[model samples]
Target chain A: MRRRIPQLVCGLFGLVTFLCYFSSHPIARKIYLTVTLDYWQIIFAFTLIVGALSFVRVNLRAVERGEDRPYKIVSLIGVVLMPILALIWGIRGGSPFMWVFENIQVPMQATVFSLLAFFVASASYRGFRARSLQAAILLGAALLILISRSSIGDLIWDRIPEAAEWVRSNPAMSARRAILIGIGLGSLTTSVRVLVGIERTWLGGEK
Target chain B: MDVGTLVAGLLTLAILTFLYRDNPIYKMAESLLIGVAIGYVLVVTWTNSLMALLFTPLFSRGELWLIVPFALGFLMFGRLHRRTAILSRIPIGVLIGSGAGVAIPAMLEARTLRQLSATVGPVFADGTVDISMVVVLLGVLSTLIYFYFSREQVGWWGRTARLGTWFLMIFFGTTFGYTVMSRMSTFIGRMEFLLSDFLRIIS
Candidate 1:
């Protein structure tokens, strides 16, 4: 009974929402907009709380187990401190909360992402070996694109940039479009399955 | 020197320290990042979403129907308890159903139909046989064929799929090259920040 009720609710909502897209009726449109804009936002807020609680639980357990205790403690402190700062000072552009965000968070994120450059370089060095036809083609294309984007391509040959652009717009774009179509079809099938109550993984384990 | 810039520089260096080796400083920075991210999200979600959308309308506008969603949102917390976990599935069901409902038509129209139309359209300009257009058309057709896993890739189909593989390789190589360029640009930006803003070594 527990599982069946949720599945029915899912199918009913799914059908209604799907119909709302096609229906020009004022009531249907209103319901669609309200469910999407208002209800979704509220649900997402609760989901965020759930996520935060999970984070606290995992890290607290780690700290209690004395596994990476110092770092876990530091993480917990940051989680606790930032919200308190926001609540007390507000998150206005010039507030301390924003300061920490702009200075600390932004810089940390950028630097971490920037580290990817080194990893990519190392990965390319190891993976871009030209032992076969496909490998040779891939290596050549990668090198050509990389060089064309840099000053060295213009220094070497004037037509390199044009060739790179042609490769990107022609073969690359076509392949990308094909992939998109496949994704679209797959997503549509999944949506239909969910709407019809054939897919119930979202309900979690059987209760 | 401003305290903000100094702190930013320190954090950036702490993160960059990971490139050398995983150490205590890097671990500390990583933990701090996760913590601050959660905190930031919590504040934004509470103030912008919960307060502005849920609370204001329910209280100020006296929208009694808002209670339904509020109750559903509250029920999501039942997930924390084993016995009442079944209650959480109702909200989860609705979220997935509504989300899937919204995505269906959009994906078909925007992704599949549009791409199909674009692929089958004119492969040349007026009075000119465009080579690029031919390549694009062939590439699209062959790639789609390659992705068809239901049938055996034999004879003509196999050769066509092989050609499609080459096209895919070129696409992936270009993507990787572009990604490398992007990451390099990011790296350069941080270097510029460190040199000019932090150290005052450049104008």
Candidate 2:
């Protein structure tokens, strides 16, 4: 009964929203905006609670089970420290909480990302081989993009820039547009399914 | 060198250690990223949604509108109890109804009409060289033709379909290449952030 009612309401809402497409009423637009705002709110509300639980659940179990859990304690400590600090001093500067975020969080994010350069280089080397006709075209496009994007290409050559411009404007952009068209059709079907309650995966799995 | 730059450089070195093999530096860096993301999400949710829709309406004077969302928020939390999972349906229904109401016109405008119009334009502009416009027209024609599942393709139309398929493959191949380049750029940008902003090893 619980599942049945939500599905039915969803179906009706979907029908009205779909019909709203045929008109330009301000009332309809307001309804649309309100619904979207609430949806975004609900998603965040759920995730925030879930993240909190992850810290508590993992650490509590680690202590009880006597596992190799040194890091769990540090994680739990971080979770508690910032919120408490924020509640007392607020999250602004001259507060330890904000200091931790700047000194710790941002740098860690940077550290993680620095690893990606090596990954990108390796991925490019293996994928951009020119064995087939299509591969040859791709390799041509890639070299153009890489050269145009970098300072080294401009230092030694001017024709490289011209060729890169030609590849990007003609072949690359045209190809991107076509892919976007296909992606558009797929998104339409997805939205329609969600409206009709046929796609319950987004709502967390089927009844 | 300043402390900020020295630490940023060391962080970069620490992260790059993963390239040789995974180690303690990578683990610490990974944990820090996860912690920051979780904290940001929490703060945003509290300020943006809970504060706007829930707290203000309920606590503020002369605002009876809070009752509806407060009840709905409570309804969502009812899922915590096994016997009261049925109560969650009300909030869930409201969510779906509102979602479908919002997505209709924006999707049509942004995804459908604008895109179709882009495809149905002239290849040449002012009788000048427009290689992009020409490639675009050809790509649109070939893809649209390839998906001709409704009609028979027994004659010259079959030949066109075959050509269309080849064009479709090339188009997809190029798209894949661009996607790779875009992802790599993002990765590079992230690396730059670590080196310059976090570690301060590189200017």
Candidate 3:
């Protein structure tokens, strides 16, 4: 009874939401707008809280087991501290919360992401070898794109930039479009599967 | 130097130190990053979503209909308890159902139909046959065929799929190059921040 009810609710809601998109009746539109805009956002917010709780639980377990105790403690402190700061001081633009965010969080994220530059360089050096026809074509195309986007290509040859642009607009765009179509079909099929009772993986193992 | 900038500079350096080897400082910074990110999200969600959308409407406006979603949202917390964990499935089901329903038609319109329409365009522009249009037409068709796994890739089918692969390679190559350029630009920005903003090495 427990499992059956949720599955029924899922199928009903899925059908309603899908039908609501096509329906222009005042009642349908109102329900659709309310659910999509308000309810979805509220649900997503709760999911974030759930995520935070899960993080705390996992880290607490790690600390209890005495695995990398110092770092785990730092992480736990950070998770607890920031919310208290936000709630107490309020997250106004000039508040302590925002100050920490702008300075500490933003810089750290930027630095971490920027490290991808070095990783990409190392990865490309290892992977971008011209061993076969496909590899040679890929390497050539990559070189053309890199050169065309920089000032060096214009200095070396006038036509290189034009050739690169042609490659992008023609073959690259066509392949991208084909991939997008495949993704669209795949998403549609999966959505249908979820709407039916066939996709029960979200129920999370025979509970 | 100011405290915030000084702290940011040190943290940036600490994170960058990971390139050399994983160490205590890098681990601490990574954890702090995760914590601060979640905290920020919690604050934003509370203010923008929960308080404004859920609580305000339910209490101040006296909208009783909102109780349905409010109850559903609360049920999500049931996962924390072993006995009530099955109750969490209700909310999860609703989320998946609504999300999928919303995405289906949108993807059909934006990705499939639009893409198909775009692919089938005028091959002949003015008095001349456009070479670029021909390339796009052939590329899209062949790539789609290559993706079709129902048939075995032997003889002529293999040759066509091979042609499709060449087009895909060009697409992938250009994407990788662009990504490299973007990451390199970000790396340069961080360097500028450290050099000019933090150390005052450049104006």
Candidate 4:
């Protein structure tokens, strides 16, 4: 009974979704959208509970081990208290939980990103050398885009923006589109396996 | 300025401080971020997935079919066991197969055909070449030739290919640099918001 549950789902909805695309029936598309956006969205949403449980389990274990005990306790407190407060009162634009969120999480994500900036400049200084014809062209493109992006570049050369725009629209967008196709293909392969009931790792182990 | 956006902005600045050097402000900003992410995930899941999907269906349909994904999702917990862990493959396989069905054709059409056709396209489009078409044709030819590593060059073909390679290299280099700056800007943008918004809490 336990084993049959997920296979049943993939079979029912997954099969319908696959068939829906080629079918002329409007119902197929509607059902497809509902299953994907509504049903799949629900399943994915609840997965967060899995993460919260893991967070609690690891942090509590850390507290038991007498290592980084203080931080672990603080983490556990935040994990527990914030959610309780949120569920009881709700979190939105003006609530305290929401306030804590905007003030805190945004900064952390931003800080991680900012650190990436210094790393960028350092990498540029060290590695931005031309070794071949291809390297030289790439460097030229980089220079064009860089100058055009900042106000300084606009002052030096009016053509920089136009040139950069052309490159991005033509070459960069083309390359990114190519990569996205590859990624899309890869995603399809995974999804097909899931639908067929042959993939099942998300269910926790192999059948 | 609204009090909410103001507090959020301060935290953003505090985070950006790390661009210069790490400090107490940065740490405070970091801690706040972790809390918020955790909180967001919980709240979002509860409202979006739980309330909308499961709870709604349970109340409205009284249909037991909703338990299908729920039960299978619980099977994800089977990984904790020692011997029976292979059971995880059930859900994973379905995910993989479904993913493949959608992705494979998309991959071929978008990645392979569109690009090959795009490169060979401009010249043939409307059965004629304009000035812009000429430049695009030249760009494509040169870039393609640039990658030819083993082709011996002693004739016109060799010289043309060499120029092609040169054009490709310069284009790639500048692109690399701009990508770096964009990343930095993203980082800066986040911190600027935090410092400007969150610091208001103290003030």
Candidate 5:
């Protein structure tokens, strides 16, 4: 009953949504909009909350196990504190919640991503080896782009930027278009599969 | 510096300490970042989605249809327990099913048909040979052919597929370069913040 019912619901919703696209009827439009906008967000928000609770549970478990308790506790505090702050002070500008977001969250996140710059540089040293023609081509393209984007490319040759632009617009664009087409077709098929209940993997193991 | 600047600068430095090695300071900041990010998302989702859509309409405005979503959303909490875990599948199924339905037409129209049309469109423009257009056409065709795994790749097909790899390589290289450059710029930005805001070393 559990497996069959969910599959039935999936097929029903999928079929309705698919049919709504060819439908200009107001009822269809209403159904489509309500599902896409309201229900999507509501359900998605619930999932996020569930995920947050699960994170808390995991951290609490770790703390119980004495595995990096301090860090886990810090994480727990962070998870617990933000919502409390938002609830009390509200998340508006000049609020504690916003303050944490702007100062603590934003700076830390930016620094974390920026730290990847060093790793990417280290990676390129290993990745840019040109033992094969393809490797050489890849290296050349990267170098061309890097140089063109920097201040020194115009010093070496004025056409470096133009050549880089040409490579991007023509060759790179072609590959991108092909990739997009592949993704589109893939998504279409998968959506159809989901509609037909062939993709019941989401229902989990053992029915 | 003000407290906000000082706190941000310190947190930024703490995160940057991973360059030396992964230590207590970096892990602390990383944990806090993850937790705080979740909290921020929770607040945002509650305010923007749950409260506004589900709660406001259903309770404040007396729109009864919202109970449907509320009930579905409540089912999501079933994931917390082993016995009730099966109930979560109903919401997941609905989300995935509707999402897939919406994606079908969108994927066909925007990604597939539009791209296909744009690729073939310019080549046929004015019946004149534009070198760039020709390159683009060749690139798209060869790349697609490379992805076609149904046939055994040999002879002319093999060569075409090989040409596709070169285009793919160029694409990868360009993307990698852009990513590195962007990250480098952000790193530079953090440095600027530290120097100008925190240390007052640079104007």
Candidate 6:
């Protein structure tokens, strides 16, 4: 009954949503809007909150077990502190919550992401071997783009950027379009499968 | 120095410490970043989504249908307990189904049909054969054929598929190059902050 009920719900909602697109009836449009906007947002928010709560629970358990105690505590402190700060001052601009977010979260996040550049450079150094035709083409394209984007390329050859732009707009764009089409078809099939109960993986195992 | 710059600078430096090697400081900064990011999301979701969408409508405006989503959302917490875990599937089903439903027409219109139309739109312009459009058409065709695995790839089909891969590689290379450049810019921004904002080495 548990599995059947959810499957029915999935199929029903999927059918309704899919049908709503073709229908201009006010109720259909309203249902579509309500489902997409309100219900989706509320459900998504709760999902996120649940995820954050789970993180806290897992970290608390770890702290209890004496695993990376100080770091876990620091994480827990950040988690706990932000809400309290928000509650006390609100998340308005220039509030303490925003202050922590701008200073602590944003900078750290940017720096961490920026760290990827060094890793990418090192990885490219090790892995970007051009021993084959395809590899050569890939390497050539990457080098062309890199050169075109920088000032040194213009100094070396003014048309380098133009050539890179041609590669980007024509061949690269065509391939990207093909991939998008493939993704579109794939999504359609997957959605249909889920709706039809063929893709019960979301139900999470054979209960 | 102002506290914001000082704190941001120190944390930024702490994160950059990971490049040297993962150390306690880097781990600490990473952990704090995760926690704070989650907390920020929680706050934003509560204020923007839960408060405005769900609570305001249900409590103030007395929208009764809003209760359905509230109940579905509440069911998501069933995931935390094994006994009640199956209840979570109902909400998951609704989310997936509705998302998939909307995506059906959206993907077809935007990704597939639009791309097809654009590709087949114009192969000639101003009384001359537009070479770029022709190439785009050929690229799209060859790429699609490359993915058609129903038949064995051999002869001319093999060649077209191989050409498709070259085009794909070009696309991938361009994407990689762009990503690297973006990250490089971010890295530059961080360096500027460290040098100009923090150390006052440059104005």
DockQ for every model comes to: 0.80, 0.37, 0.77, 0.34, 0.86, 0.86
Candidates in order have lDDT scores of: 0.90, 0.63, 0.89, 0.63, 0.92, 0.93
Residue-level lDDT tens digits of model 6 in B126-184:
89999999999989999999999998899999999999999999999999999899999
Whose TM-score is higher: candidate 1's or candidate 6's? 6
**Interface CA root-mean-square deviation for model 3:** 1.3
Query: Which regions of candidate 5 fall more than 4 Å away from where they truly are?
Result: B124-128
Cα RMSD to the true fold for all candidates: 1.3, 4.1, 1.5, 5.3, 1.1, 0.9
Q: Which residue pairs in candidate 6 collide?
A: none
Where does model 4 exceed 4 Å of error?
A1-16, A177-207, B1-32, B60-63, B80-84, B108-120, B124-128, B131-178, B184-203
TM-score of each: 0.97, 0.80, 0.96, 0.75, 0.98, 0.98
lDDT tens per residue, model 4, A29-148? 776566556555654664567667767787788889997676566667667767886877787777877766665565456567667777777877787677865665666778777788
* CAPRI-style grade of the A/B interface in model 3: medium
Over 4 Å off, model 1:
none
Cα lDDT tens digits, model 3, B1-203, are 89999999999999999999999899999988987887778888888999999999899999999899899999989888889888888888888888788878888999899999999999888999989889999999889889999999889998898889999999999898888888878888999999988999999
iRMSD (1 decimal) for each model: 1.1, 3.6, 1.3, 4.3, 0.8, 0.7
For the record, the alpha-carbon RMSD of candidate 6 to the native fold, in angstroms, is 0.9
State the fnat of model 2.
0.29
Candidate 4, position A58, lDDT: 79
Distance from true location, Cα of A27 in model 4, Å:
4.8
Per-residue CA lDDT of candidate 5, range A1-207, in tens? 989998888888988998997899999999999999999999999999999999999999999999999999999999999999999999989999999999999999999999999999998897679999889888988898999999899999999999999998889889989999999999999999989988888899966
Pairs with backbone N, CA or C atoms under 3 Å apart (clashes), candidate 2: B8-B198, B8-B199, B9-B199
DockQ comparison, 2 vs 6, better candidate: 6
Report the number of the highest-DockQ candidate: 5
Residue ranges of candidate 3 with Cα displaced over 4 Å: none
